[model samples]
Target: MSNEAMQVRALRGRVVTPDHIIDDGAVVLSGSHIAWVGTADQAARAGFGDAVEQAQTAPEGGYLLPGLVDVHCHGGGGESFPNAETAEQAMVSVLEHRRFGTTSLVASCVTAAPDVLRARTRVLAGLCEDGELAGIHFEGPFVSVERCGAQDPTYIIDPDAALTRELIELGGGHVVTMTIAPEKPGITGDDGVNAALIEGGALPSFGHT
Candidate 1:
């Protein structure tokens, strides 16, 4: 079948596939679903496990699952979203984690105005579509100033569904996750704005107020 239909197998070193360890585990992948998993002997009977026993030159080590998926990381390497500012410059931050095994990455942005956010999303969305990026995450611009972490308080605003929808659309499908403080004390003008954003294809995650 298609590679996408194939399973995830990490026989030798480290593989942390989506979850815990496999140890000397044998992983059977079918499509995106794990068809089977057990010991080396069990996998040998069914076919597929650590080849350590079958090898003499390979590293004498335990079997690692698959790599990890960092859903909340900012930029890559020493580059950060706020520091990088622009999406183009932001890529350096993205590639930093790919080496160790970050298959997917979300380009997070600071609290900026609608136009700036749109511009950043436009670039990040393109990167994601081109396979260089995975998704875009907006952490602020809708957070509570009272509880703002390291983010700039000047960019904080009450959650607005209209802007949120626009931002997502601008990012294309590259925009998937959003960290919003739903309890923020704004959003007074529009009707059903919250529902529109929460339901309009964006995964809204509650953040600190």
Candidate 2:
């Protein structure tokens, strides 16, 4: 058997799965993956009674759910991803969110000057390449100013294809997604900014109006 299948660890709690919830459920972890899941009693009766590597149980009234994915998190731990000057500072938010059960996150950047956005994307891209962050998200210079809740309206403008391509190239294949306002002026057709994003393998997600 593979090493992963040979080693077993278990967690018991109020397990929450996609299909249903087990009030007193158990999950068996084999190496890094979940090997089995069911009620606590079922686990005890189903071959897991043998010597296992480790076991954990939740506190009374605690629940066990899958790690969360935050798609648009700007910051945590008093550090802002868009405002971070260095990778270490940016990682502060990454680690902080992970500590709270967010296992997957995208570092989102807000509207900023072209140079500022490029510099920050470089930092976040490095993090993505190093596996510290899932990817980078540009929340825009391509969005509508009237609906840009927290973004700097001063930096907001019509989508520019050249700038779009530049940011993606700088990200080095780690530009997983970006936000844009489809209704924003000059953002449609062949020369549009959204098309540039697609050609660069980044998802042109419509958001922030």
All candidates: CA RMSD in angstroms? Answer: 4.5, 2.3
Output the worst ten-in-a-row residue range by lDDT, candidate 2: 46-55
Question: What is the RMSD of candidate 2?
Answer: 2.3
lDDT of each residue in 118-154, candidate 1, tens digit only: 7777777778788877777888787778888877887
* lDDT string, candidate 2, 1-209, tens digits: 78966678888889999999999788888777788888877765677754222458789998889989988889999999899989999999999999889988989999999999999998999999998888889999889888898888999988899999999999999887888999976688899988898899989999888
Q: What are the lDDT scores of the predictions, listed in order?
A: 0.66, 0.87
Cand. 2 TM to true fold: 0.88
Model 2 misses residue 152 by how many Å? 1.2
Deviation of model 2 at 63, angstroms: 1.5
Backbone clash count, each prediction separately? 9, 0
Q: Please, what is the TM-score per model?
A: 0.69, 0.88
How high is the lDDT of residue 135 in model 1?
75
Candidate 1 CA-lDDT value = 0.66
